[model samples]
Target chain A: MTAHPLHVPPGPVDLDAIATDATPGYGGSKSDGKAALEGLGPELADLQERLFAEGRATGSRRRVLLVLQGMDTSGKGGTLRHTVGLVDPQGVRISSFKAPTADELAHDFLWRIRRAVPAPGYLGVFDRSHYEDVLIARVNELAAPEEIERRYDAINEFERELVEDGTVVLKCLLHISKDEQRERLLARLDNPEKYWKYEPGDIDARARWDDYRAAYELALERTNTAHAPWHVVPSDRKWFRNLAVGTLLLDALRGLDLGWPAADFDVDAERARLLASEAST
Target chain B: MTAHPLHVPPGPVDLDAIATDATPGYGGSKSDGKAALEGLGPELADLQERLFAEGRATGSRRRVLLVLQGMDTSGKGGTLRHTVGLVDPQGVRISSFKAPTADELAHDFLWRIRRAVPAPGYLGVFDRSHYEDVLIARVNELAAPEEIERRYDAINEFERELVEDGTVVLKCLLHISKDEQRERLLARLDNPEKYWKYEPGDIDARARWDDYRAAYELALERTNTAHAPWHVVPSDRKWFRNLAVGTLLLDALRGLDLGWPAADFDVDAERARLLASEAST
Candidate 1:
């Protein structure tokens, strides 16, 4: 069995070279990948508690921010359900950024983004993040070229600040082919039950494929900083996408090297209190 | 294979008669009960979407409110994971009411409860609900007997309004024996990994077991109105508790008999637009 590489480090990333169907970091079949995912559940739960406890402790500023940016059928929701679903909800904050509201549009783009950052001792997940401003904004000419360029620099500075202040920023671009998106959209149309999830405007989004791809390439190249690097995940195969993203997340948490805080109080006295209280009752 | 009777209708209640060890509604082993729970997932997802779509459609106000009240270690979290975990997060609302803050204490107790009701087309679960006002308040003498009795009447009236407005309120008391609580508390103590979940104050709560049980019985009897009936779920066997509660919830949903709302737009025109759009591109 060959070792699968999960992370694409901060450097020049060739989007075309990464196949959407390739399964890296997975040794066996779907069942095996599932078993592996199940195995990670308890570890994530335990690690999450320590992160939570550390945050709850005096002046500990440790947390994680996972940004998942992808095309419409690239399986961000599936990844969240399969991976982050394993941990206790108490320690995980999910921020699904939708379109800007009237008040939200009144503020800067990062204003809502800043408001949604996870507190210390949390594993925060951003479903569609501020990256949309660069991706969709550039593709559709929502912002001027000069403004978009300025936004990229602003994003880099914001991420650097987050990293310096104790947050681990992991950004993943769920890479899928245009053909895959077409099939997924068609399936939603065929199933009436899935009508709530479909939108005719998605067809328009598909028409801007090349533009979006070029915008993504520029965004990936421009903002892949050392402090907050970008990972390109092949997301056509749902199971493999779940596996790779889960692997990346587990590795990142493991890298934190968090330890249980030592009990500052006398353990013997607490045990004695329990014993004494039991006898009195 | 004996059938289990899980739901207790609106009537006088007895805490002692319900056997915590029994696993009714489940005729098979743990693996089989698990398989049954798994089967409910897709149906729940489908029903939830219809409910969500119905809510989104127009003015249809159909929803589910599952109030889970249990003593310590009766598996409210476990039930949430196994059962409600199956549905989409988009169509579910979870309100885990903890001890009230100073602002909350200043207002009437039901003020906070009113704030967390589920919107139309969502299945809402309250982890520790408004019943705490009656349970802990009565047991710990936080409120006078007259005030506690008044709260019972207030609760019934509040629930009546919810029922009239298209909410099916299913209140479940996860009834576990004192012995089961002791075992679970000790298990938490024995495992270092689970220390974060363990509270030292739990032992003090156990000391007032009979008082709590009597409180639950009186609360159940007083508030068991026709609009919102209390279901005493025997929860010692974790698998059975999930199955019984899951069954009750699924039944309640099926009872609503919801259907997918018809597409308001012209279907042929939309399909033709997609086909034409594809050819033009």
Candidate 2:
């Protein structure tokens, strides 16, 4: 196995030195990788059904969230369309965090993210999540150095609460090279079909790439917790990125002690009544 | 024309007297209605494009919000799937408000709603919106009667601000009969497939049907402002319901003076450069 381990355990790590293209745990060909990704769909769907069913039936509410943080054109949307797309849209809650609105900026940063967090049985995907506070806010000097430092602790406490309340939190930092980003942005500008996806401000973000990277490094080191560890996925290869995320979801789901809630109703009587009604109608 | 009118202009309306199956503006057969719905897709698509485009371009940032309020099984989800379904999902933002969390309940009712209103160039749908404050809160006596009264004015003022800020606010109350709701609930109970969608708490809501109706009547009469009027939708018939909302959305879209934004970039130069870059790559 070429060691591109995607999951970073709660510990000290240097994001600056991590290879964005490393596929440490993947030992498969591109064909095998794609096949593996496709294969996980059924398991995910089944797990989601059980989770959703459980939430409806009982007091214990189980939820899963994937928090995605990345640079411009780092395949967040692609991951959404491919990985989360496999689940029932009804069971999935996707909250894409754009630049905060004036109203949102007035409140705490997590206010919007907290509202959008998946309810029990939902598989939530944060397209660009609360990590923006640390990444963008830090890089742009939007907040003071000390205040930026304080966000790391606040985020950890929040995730701890989510985990305590039965929500599995998996954060992924999509690590892509600046060169790859330039190519992607150029592709967007070049393709008329993709012009809608382009924003002139993305170029502004791109200009602050190094500063953003430094900010990300600090975020990963400071906030990554045992409860909500950050996984820096090598995202230069889009295929590998999807496969890695899909596998992580599959593992998290399968690890849960999950089952369908037993139906409390008299099914035979209900079924008979429905049949009688249908005949009468 | 089998007239099934969709829009309810701002006015005093009696919820008790309002027909749950009134389709005065819809004069078509089922097949005709479905076709008209299918037919509106492209124009809705076009209007949505212009709305979304206008937002992305400089200066003018127009938007729309369709707030759906109804009793349990009144087909809010169906409307979302069928009516809002016609537009590009990318251009649509759907916020399904559930029971507020401890954190949310701590704040004012409109806090979460204000956060979820669509950005410029987006058509936002509230699957069960702030009206819950007045409906459920009033029906359950969750707040003091005086406090409940305050929310109506608060909602109107909140909505007025949204209108003043360039969002076309359309509120729809999907009015389904108590008899119709009973049938829907029984259907869910009878069919195993629908058991997931059936919440046990719905029966409790069903029990308070009259109270809820009274609450709805008061809400409709009080908050039906010229700025953000409430339309009582005849949702007992699903197809008519879908068609009515679709037509309402189409009319709202057409009502807007929208056009594709002129390109801000040097299109010819950008295109030529993209073409040249493609050749080199």
Worst 10 residues of 1 chain B by lDDT: B272-281
What's each prediction's clash count? 2, 16
Error of 2 at A55 (Å): 4.1
Model 1 segments more than 4 A misplaced: A1-18, A24-63, A86-93, A103-122, A137-167, A221-223, A258-281, B1-13, B24-42, B45-61, B87-93, B102-121, B137-166, B264-268, B275-281
True contacts kept of 2: 0.05
Give TM-score, chain B, model 2.
0.94
Task: Write candidate 1's Cα lDDT for A52-133 as tens digits.
Answer: 7777643678799989998888888788878887776556767778778889989888999998888888888999999999
True contacts kept of each: 0.06, 0.05
Candidates in order have lDDT scores of: 0.80, 0.78
- Across all models, the iRMS values in order are 4.0, 6.4
Candidate 1 lDDT, tens digit per residue, B16-112?
8888988765669878877887887788777876787888664788899999999889999888877887776645667778889899999999999
Candidate 2: count the clashes: 16
Residue-by-residue lDDT tens digits, candidate 2, B1-281? 43344455555666656677767676778898888888888888789877877776647757999988998899988787677766655567778898898989999998988889888888888889999999999988888999998999998899889999999998888988877877887887766656766665676676677788788878887888888877778888888888888878888899997765665676566545433432210
The local lDDT score (0 to 100) that residue B38 gets in candidate 2 is 88
